[model samples]
Target: MAINIRNAVIQNVTGNSREELEDTIVDAVQSGEELMLPGLGVLFEIIWQNASENDKKEMLQRLAGGLAK
Candidate 1:
């Protein structure tokens, strides 16, 4: 038998685009899921590779501060 139409849930709408994806990602980030960190870390690593020595030092300092907690 055919099923009756009922309330449905939409995960991601077709009208939703990359901007929506970014907003979802940002919301997930604020919710404290570390699953997003690896991508961000890779980006940081790429930038670090071309950064100056002083920049690396400053980056290390910031990383240390984040690690302390």
Candidate 2:
């Protein structure tokens, strides 16, 4: 299943500014706010949408290292 970026982005409640909305996403990342994807497919899509290839690779590496704990 595909997560509609249009819907995901615009369907949310109104906000004051773009900076404020982006800050919310940043906070979600830092706070490990798990997304409620329709399925794992949508989840992976969202991950790729947010991260470039290198970013995903680096994040995966760090995630692996963290998991070693």
Candidate 3:
């Protein structure tokens, strides 16, 4: 069976308030489990898609800086 994980993750979080979403993200990160990475990737993908060019550049810069450290 082909399961669409990204869509599933999005659907699972659907209708969440800003605080709920923030709490979900914080919980996932704090869990430190490998399984959560895909969900986090889905979240990042959504953010990337909605971001403006300048926002994208800033995110890239921050990512690069983090990696350099």
Candidate 4:
């Protein structure tokens, strides 16, 4: 059987409130654990899917700027 980790992560956080989600993200980043990367990627994918073109461009620009540093 194939495991869909992205879907699993999404399901794990399903119905999370904005504050709860923010807390989860903050905790994950503060921990600096590689294990949390997949979950963060999944969250970013969701945001990318819902973002407007302008928002997407801004995100890309920010990411690029951060990477440049």
What is the lDDT of every predicted structure here?
A: 0.61, 0.62, 0.97, 0.95
Q: Please identify model 2 stretches exceeding 4 Å from their true place.
A: 1-10, 13-45
| Ranking according to TM-score, highest score first | 3, 4, 1, 2
After superposition, the stretches of candidate 3 with alpha carbons farther than 4 Å from their true spots are none
Evaluated against the true structure, the overall lDDT of model 4 is 0.95
Encode model 3's per-residue lDDT on 1-69: one tens digit a residue: 999999999999999999999998999999999999999999999999999999999999999999999
Q: Write candidate 4's Cα lDDT for 1-69 as tens digits.
A: 998989998998899999999999999999999999999999999999999999999999999999999
| lDDT tens readout by residue for model 2, 1-69 | 986664565446245486875675556667664563332334355577899889999988998999999
| Alpha-carbon RMSD of each model | 11.8, 5.9, 0.9, 1.1
Off by over 4 Å in 4: none
User: Evaluated with TM-score, which candidate comes out highest?
Assistant: 3
In candidate 3 the C-alpha lDDT for residue 4 amounts to 97
Q: What is the alpha-carbon lDDT of model 3 when measured against the actual structure?
A: 0.97
Q: Which pairs of residues collide in model 1?
A: none
Error of 3 at 68 (Å): 1.5
